[model samples]
Target: MKKYIIILSSVIIIIALGGIYMKHQYDERQEKNKTAESELYEKAKKRMTDYINANYEGIDKINFSNNYKMDQMGGINAEGYLNGDKSKEFWGIYDKSNNIITSSYVDAKEKPACKEKPCKY
Candidate 1:
């Protein structure tokens, strides 16, 4: 009877240890996933900035922040003051798949504006 009791206790301990190890592994995996997500977001933002710079020289010199958009053909949207001038603000939209800037609009005078619906891209 004593031997049987010892065996049962040992089994319970082993099972408990296993559960603890699994929980630790799960926590580690979650941390890694979070880190990967952050890295990906930063890389995408950089790509967006680079794309804008390639087209509009020196635009990348200014600080630009991007956010995930979820409305109306969602994509990464970034807007900031151009050439450090608040009045010259510009906004850009990056493609969701390639993280490439596809459309950009700058505030300027005497610009051909689009106010009507079904504007051609």
Candidate 2:
């Protein structure tokens, strides 16, 4: 009976350790995924910024939404405000081709606009 009890306890300890290790591994994977996602977003933002700078020029104080629409054809659509004015909204579209991200932007017609200065980007 004593030998059986020792065996059972040892098995339980082994199972607990295994569970802990598995949990640690799962946590590490999640962290890695989050880091990768952050990096991707930064790169996308950079592409969008380049597009804005090349076309718009002389734009100050811009804000972009954290959430963007993604399509299966490797396109991403993003929305943002210009010159800290919510009414002055715009949309940017990014396409990925051959590992290169290209971007374009347009004024948001659906959203209402204000006659604010320094809001054209």
Candidate 3:
């Protein structure tokens, strides 16, 4: 009876240790995923801003619907679209302060080449 009790205790300890190890691994994976997601968000925001600065001159305010469709394109793909869409109203601003253009969304079109100031979207 004593031997049997010892054997059962040993088995329980092993199982408990295994469970703890698995939980640690799961937590690590979750943290990694969260970090990756955060990095992607930052990259997307930067790309959007750069696009806006290059395309429009004298931007004052950028307005867009709340449904900005951020998920459809991840970081790299979203940057590509910003580079390509000339007509998309992705940025707006009211004034250039300290040579900085501020907008709600990044407009990703080349500064208008024509001499006449382009019409606001």
Top lDDT model: 2
CA deviation > 4 Å runs, candidate 2? 68-78, 93-105, 108-121
lDDT of 2 by residue, 57-101 (tens): 346756888887766775666668777888877676666553334
Which regions of candidate 1 are displaced past 4 Å?
51-121
Ranking by lDDT: 2, 1, 3
Count residue pairs with overlapping backbones in model 1.
Answer: 0
Model 3 clash tally?
12
Query: Best candidate, TM-score-wise?
Result: 2
Against the reference, the lDDT scores of all candidates come to: 0.60, 0.64, 0.49
Instruction: Give a tens-digit lDDT track for model 1, residues 1-121.
Output: 9999999999999999999999999999999966765565565566655544544444435555444443366455666666677777766666667556567665533212333321232
- Return the TM-score for each candidate structure: 0.49, 0.67, 0.51
- Give the residue spans of candidate 3 off by over 4 A: 57-111, 114-121
Report the Cα lDDT for candidate 2.
0.64
Backbone clash count, each prediction separately = 0, 0, 12
